[model samples]
Structures are given as structure tokens and as C-alpha cells.
Target: MNEQTKKQYTMAVLNLLQPKIASLVKEAHPVYQEDLEQELKLKMLEKMQTPFLHNIPSFFEFVSSNEKK
Candidate 1:
């Protein structure tokens, strides 16, 4: 794949991880809700250089791939 495609893939992976990561952070450090939310927002924005896909394959590809491995 091209560089842009690779970046998109990485961002897609990060986007998939955001909720789990944020939850882990919150669980580990319960007092940091505001900071964790802010950081998660920034990280999500960084991943979402393009608008996110609402369609099925684009949204679920990462999760499905993980399950297969």
C-alpha cells in the first residue's frame, strides 16, 4: 500500500483501540477522567484525518482482523 493508505490503516487501528485504551486508563487512574477524555479526544482527532466511515467493512475490518489472529 502507499504511504497515505498506510497512515489511514494506522489511524483506523488507533480509532479501534481508543475506547479500550481510554477505559484502561480510567480504570488504572480513576481520578484522571477529564485529562483522559481530553487526551482521548486529541488522539482520536489525530487518527481521524479523514472523516470516519459509517459503512460496515470499513468500520469492522480492524476488529475482524484481530479476531482472526
Candidate 2:
């Protein structure tokens, strides 16, 4: 299969499997409720932007490479 066709097929399979996988995860991990909530909170905090941020050249370089491709 071509690259585009393979990508489409993979996305279709992931869409079909996502709900089933989520259900299984929920059933199997009924014990990590507090940990999950804490982890989610940490992720939210990490994503917050502060006013005193410095410019990172490496991050900009990575983004430029992706845009070129």
C-alpha cells in the first residue's frame, strides 16, 4: 500500500479500537483514581505559560524542520 493509504488504514483502525481499549483500561485500573487525577493536574500545570519565559533556539529549529518536511 502507498503511504497515504497506509496512514488512512492505521487511523481507521485506531478509531475503531480506541473505545474498546478505553473500556478495558477503565475496568482493569480501578485503583489508580487518585494518581490519575494528580498526574492530570501536573500536566495542566506544566502546559501553563509564564511571563518570564526565555527563547529556546532548539525548539524553534525542531519546529522549522517539521514545517519544511
Pairs with steric clashes in candidate 1: none
Residue 22 displacement in candidate 1 (angstroms): 0.5
Q: Clash pairs of candidate 2?
A: none
Q: How many clashing pairs does model 1 include?
A: 0
Over the stretch 1-69, how does candidate 1's per-residue lDDT look in tens digits?
Answer: 587886787778777887787776777566787787768767766755554543336548978888999
Clashes of each: 0, 0
> What value does the lDDT take at residue 6 in candidate 1?
65
Question: Whose TM-score is greatest here?
Answer: 1
The residue-by-residue lDDT of candidate 2 on 1-69, one tens digit each, is 477875586567556755655555565566875565456445534543233332435788989988999
Q: Please state every model's RMSD to the true fold in angstroms.
A: 10.5, 11.9
Model 1 regions more than 4 Å off: 30-69
lDDT of 1 at 34: 72
